[model samples]
Target: MNDVQIRTFQVPGARLHYEVRGTGPLLLMIPGAPADAGALAGLAACLSDRYTVVTYDQRGLSRSVLTEPPADQDVAVFSDDAHRLLAALGDEPAYVLGNSGGALTALDLAARHPERVRALVVHEPPLPELLPDRERWRAVFQDVYDTYRDQGAGMAMGRFIATVEGDGAAPPAMPDPSQMPPEALEMMGRIQGNLDHFLAHVLLPVLRFEPDIAALRSGPVPVTVGVGAASGDGVPALSARVLAERLGVEPLVFPGDHQGLATDAATGAEIIHKTLA
Candidate 1:
């Protein structure tokens, strides 16, 4: 069933562009910064056979336009956006999977509205604040922000990438553009355009976010922290381990590294199926 419907919904300060596919219990997949809904399209399609998959461009990204001028983004608002999206889409709690910074949003969401989440799977959330040398990470993030301001998105991103380079083999290379679908190409272009806003406004604020540990640890929501099998010693994986320890659960191992969800959807879908089961 390849039927997919695109829709829009107006939130407080933004209008969200979201897509719905398949038929089953609701499954919301949240993408990280600079990635809109399309980043997870493959994974969503793979899981659609057993899920009513929902994916959306977050505020100020791609088709999700900000009603007001762009500014530093807030985790609280992002969580609220997810809450509103879920409330609008269905009456029942939904299963959620968030990747990278998206995982941070999911963590905040579960902590803020535990009743709205049936279960949550956070894949390598980059919670620098949770690390042992948080101050150093904080300084690095600050430098990234400053670099974005003084230089540009490219330089800032280079610094950011250096900090999170995993011990694993590199992620899969992008397919040839000529061989790519038009929609996929469009999504890539849109994501590229979002780099400026993401680096200047979203990066530092998100990195500075501290999840409410007490709420997540004691809340009703079942939180599953996961790490890529190959993302050894990376900041994201380290943070995932720390978060899992705090939540009192071992981190679930998933295939590939941080970008696995986007690059290896079939395997990711299968693993997620087994996990949710």
Candidate 2:
């Protein structure tokens, strides 16, 4: 393992904490959920020997302070954060890998600010636009949001996780909202915040955020869409496939479902490296 350093920097409107390891071409790993950067630690470790792995806690996450007014949590803010992080690190046109919501952010950056992105490996982005019935997905997300607001975080989280992982049958049994442990509730709050913001800004602005597929088609940057083999026949995988088709590229398979990269980071890193290469 190469020497690793965890450092903090002030982006334009936020304070960001990031970890850098190894000494090679830069590779930025953007985490999906508002969960800790620790989610990507295993994959970072696996890639540290071969690349300068950069992982950060995004705004509103650990060690990162949101100094800007609480704007709608849109992909634009996330893209700006990526741009700022790259500028702060003195690396432009770096390889980027994004999972789920982070993947959406990566696409936004690549589409809006092409110069900052060298190549993009997007894994299972939850892009509703790619779905045949995007409104249905939005409704599902809305239901989860309502669950959080009314029943509290635990019930909301359990339902959301189950929905993401389960077949599109009846929603699975929810955990007792009253009995949620402190840590679980804390994590749920983080997810709830992101969900609320996404619903308000990104999800609702589906028409506006629709990627300029035509622009992407004309752009020079190489983009790869990836889906987890274990994702089942669900929205994540379906969305990935649809995005690939829209991009006029084939969909690549990673290790697991939406959370697969977090669970099998080494394998995930290897797959991503291969895609980038």
For TM-score, the strongest prediction is 1
Among all windows of ten consecutive residues in candidate 1, which has the lowest summed lDDT?
A: 165-174
lDDT of 1 at 137: 89
Off by over 4 Å in 1: 167-176
Using alpha carbons, what is the TM-score of model 2? 0.84
If scored against the real structure, what TM-score would every candidate get?
0.95, 0.84
lDDT of 2 by residue, 92-202 (tens): 589998877678778887887788889999888777666888787778777766776788656766666655665764443456778976755665566555554443344
The CA lDDT at 51 in model 1 is 96
Best by lDDT: 1
